[model samples]
Target chain A: MTWSEYGRLFLRHGWLMVAGAAVCGALALGLTTVQEPVFRARARISMIPGVMDWRMRDLTKELARNAVATFPSDELLAAVQDQIGLQTDAEGLRAGWDDGELIITIEAFAGDAATAGILARTAAREFHSRRSLQFTEQDFIEFIEFEIRNREPELQQIAPNVMTNVLAGLFVGFAAGLALVLMLHWRDEEWLLTRQAIEKSVPQPVLGRLRSN
Target chain B: MNTNPSSRQQDAQEQVAHELRALRASIELACHKPARSVVLLSPDNSVPTADAVWNLGLAFRTDTSSTLLADSDMEDPGLHLLADLDLAPGLRQWLEQKGQPASALAATHDHGLLVLAAGCSNEDPLQWLNTESIGWFAPALMACAERVIWRTPPLDQSPVGVLLAGSADAVLMAVRPGHTRRSRVNRAQRILAQAGIMATGTVLVES
Candidate 1:
């Protein structure tokens, strides 16, 4: 079909597209409201080498990478959970190294703000205590130190992003509605409005045309 | 005077007459031999088949040839209403009683054009569509006029149209743009083909 014909078809059925978008957007908003909100809390711990030696700095960097990797370990999570008396498993905890900062950032996700903050604080404290004990036993306590950077964990709601979900729903709904309109138009073989359409449909020749009264 | 409603009506009527004349010429050219009787059938009832039949009759009358417009669709007859004539004592009466064909024919404003309305009959009209009945009725109407136009109901709605089409010298299917469906027309054509009848051509009724 030509652009004008598509324009006419859209004009005739554009309401369906609008309705689909509205329903989907409303549904997304409704679902977001009812969904369980996840709260995230973050804590940063700086790993410093006591000596100015290059070899000590390299060892501290390696230790920081190790700390980041082991932050989400089941043993460390169990120790943190035990300290905080948290009933939930270690599934919601994540740790990463801040590039070139020699910092290990620990993040905790929970259903409530207090629980998320407590999880992050407890996890960082337990990691510091464990590393201190390991350094003392290995005779490296004089060369390395761990400092808790944030006095309080930074907390925020992370899940159920209403605006993004609603926009995505509207886009998906519009695409689905357009597909439905095209499918319906394709299925309808009865609408032979033009002379060329009629000629293509039937075997007999069209003799003459009359204007509508 | 130029912009008045009456002037517009006149212009519309002239345009319709011109279209009808062109249609009539096409029909005349398509038929190898002179078709004394032509049956016009529609696949759907929503089209203005009755008006086309009436206008085509008027177009045929312009040539000074005696033309008869017969409404054989007894089920939902409208030609009598179009001609502003009574429904009774028409084709039905003539078919049942075998009366004078002249009595059944009603003269129109045009001297050369006559209309045989679909008469009121309590009995089922399909019973009157047999070969014995049409064999008698055809010659009676043919004897009165040089050309006879039979306007039947939509073939999709009634089988009587296909039967009537089988007896006519030529058959033309009337189709209304947008209103008439492709499937209905194809089905009507298939019905005619099943009866060993092929439609001569199609008339696109814009209304």
Candidate 2:
């Protein structure tokens, strides 16, 4: 259909389209509002390529080293869990490997905001202490500097997934709306008489014509 | 009055007569063959006189039986003046009585044409022009005449919206040149559409 025909059709049944859009927008807002709010606490720890010095190492790492090395393996998640007291605590720590940046992210989902913040900080501390023991004293100080530099830029890059999730929901809603509009238009028999069909089907009285060979 | 005065009047009449004849021939060509009922709808008292007459003649010639011109325009029955007939009881009286004798309501014109007027004016003439009464009158009028030619009121002004009550085998709308604008013609068409009267063709009445 030409733009004019589309405009005419809409002029004829714009109310139906408006109703469909209203229903879709209302449903999207209602669904989002009624959903339970989930807050995610994320902390990032990157792998720096050196070891910490003996004298310069912090007390937080020195105290946690015994519990950190008991695992006998270099897995960042298990080491961080043991150092953070998650292995003996009431609620366990949740930490996972970041394949993209060679980083380990420790996240905890909780009903309250304060508990989630503390848990994220505690896990980061534990992971840092465990990472310190894995290298020499000189290497550890260099790694700390490297970690700080890497983390400054990396933390800036890590954003909450709320925006992505919201946009995904919007896309789904829009697609459903488009499909619904098309379905309704399909059912409307009046729209079936396209301009092409009108010109071809109806007998037109030809007064004069110029034929081009 | 001398012969010259009469001759000038005669010349004007002759011009009118020539124009009417040309209009008649055009309509005849347009409506060469018609179904059982050929209904003609107009919006006002200005009947598509020559054109309708011309078409009716064509319809009469081509159709199996005789054609009847039944004027159902209650407001101003133009056929009474055009066909030169007495103003008598027509569709309105038949509807008012509901079951009045059809024979008494009709009059034969000098041309062997049956003319049914809107009858003498009433306080609320339109009340009888409703669908129910029109439904009763249509067949009764058709039974009295063979092929019916309805001189209906202009759809724009008439409350009934259309002239014919039942399914018209063929219908035509007549518009006077220069007088009938496109909008009025469209409005009249819409009126006919609402009344479920679909015209087979249209007649352009040259002034």
Candidate 3:
């Protein structure tokens, strides 16, 4: 279609697209307004080596890194998840070791502050209990006090970034509506409405034209 | 004498007279041999084809040439009413009742122009135009008059319009601005093309 035809089609359907955009924007705003704020709490876990020796530095670092990597396993996490109040599996929970290979930070985001704090603290405790079970009676002396310490639990509420979500919804809805309008216009072939339109649609030249009242 | 013609009526008369003169010149110049029978119609059915035919016939009659105006529109025959002529013993009577051609000719009581109105009849219009009677009427009218003008129903409304065009030597389309849609014009053109008749010319009629 030429620009004139496109202009005509858009003139008819642009309002529909704008309406769709407004509906989606309202939906985004409603969702943001109704959603409760969530709180995120973090618990840091630091692994300590039994013996500090220059020759054993690499082995100590390796052990600490492995412990950090395996601390959030499902079997270890399930041990205390029942006490945490929130229904979170190992896959749904998040943990990271950016501070150092020796330290892992377990984090939980929950609708309430109590649930977030409980999840973070319980996850750290479960890791210690499972690590202790790995040592035998005779080796218990070498790995004495295999217990986890909780640092100051960081807690903050995070929810409803209104501006970002509304903007995203507006853009997505506008794009979808525009695509729909173009598709519908393309499908409608019987849209000739002018003297030039008659000439463009059919093979015959328009010898004469009469205007509509 | 229409002595009390209003200003609007006078203006309409002057416009029609001027347009008729221009149309007469167009008719003569459009073809080397002037058409014996010309079909006059409008795309939007706004132009009074009967009036155009009657005035054109009057134009020829003043020049000492007798003209025959036939209204083949059985649905709403206006040629008789427009010219104040007798409706009976008309084209329908000639086609169905086998009335004589001379009996069908209505004296318009204006400048000796003859008219053949679509008289009171319920006969199928398409069949009436296609019959062997009109087959004889075409050449017979050509021999009987100097020029012949005919009016049929709007082409889009009736198949008789294109069929009537086939009986005539030329076709004149009256298109009124602001009344006829472009699509209507295109459809009329398509119908004419389908009937193997090209419009001889177009007359732009402004309200």
**CAPRI band for model 3:** incorrect
DockQ category of candidate 1: acceptable
Q: Candidate 1: misplaced stretches above 4 Å?
A: A1-177, A180-188, A210-213, B1-7, B110-112, B121-123
After superposing candidate 3 on the true structure, give the runs of residues whose Cα lies further than 4 Å from its correct spot. A3-192, A201-213, B1-90, B98-123, B131-134, B140-159, B167-195, B199-207
- Fraction of true contacts retained by every candidate, in order, equals 0.71, 0.00, 0.04
Highest DockQ against the true fold, candidate: 1
- The true-versus-predicted C-alpha distance at residue A190 of model 3, in Å, is 3.1
Writing each residue's lDDT as its tens digit, candidate 1 over A10-81 gives 997788888888888888899999989999999998888899689998988887887777767777878876
The TM-scores, one per candidate, come to: 0.64, 0.39, 0.50
Q: Per-prediction TM-score of chain B?
A: 0.90, 0.69, 0.84
Order of all candidates by DockQ, from best down to worst?
A: 1, 3, 2
lDDT by residue for model 3 (B1-207), tens: 455659778886776667666666676566446767778766657666666566556555655677888888887677888778777768877777554677678676646878888886455577666756567767766676777788778877777777777767767776654455667777888888887887777755443
Candidate 1: residue A66 Cα off by (Å) = 21
Clashes of each: 0, 11, 0
Mind giving the per-residue lDDT tens digits that candidate 2 earns over B26-90?
Answer: 44445465355666665454446434543453335323455566656566555566555555666
| Candidate 2 - chain A - TM | 0.50
Q: What is the lDDT of residue B30 in candidate 1?
A: 80
The alpha-carbon RMSD values of the candidates against the true structure, listed in the order shown, are 8.2, 16.6, 9.2
**Total residue pair clashes for candidate 1:** 0
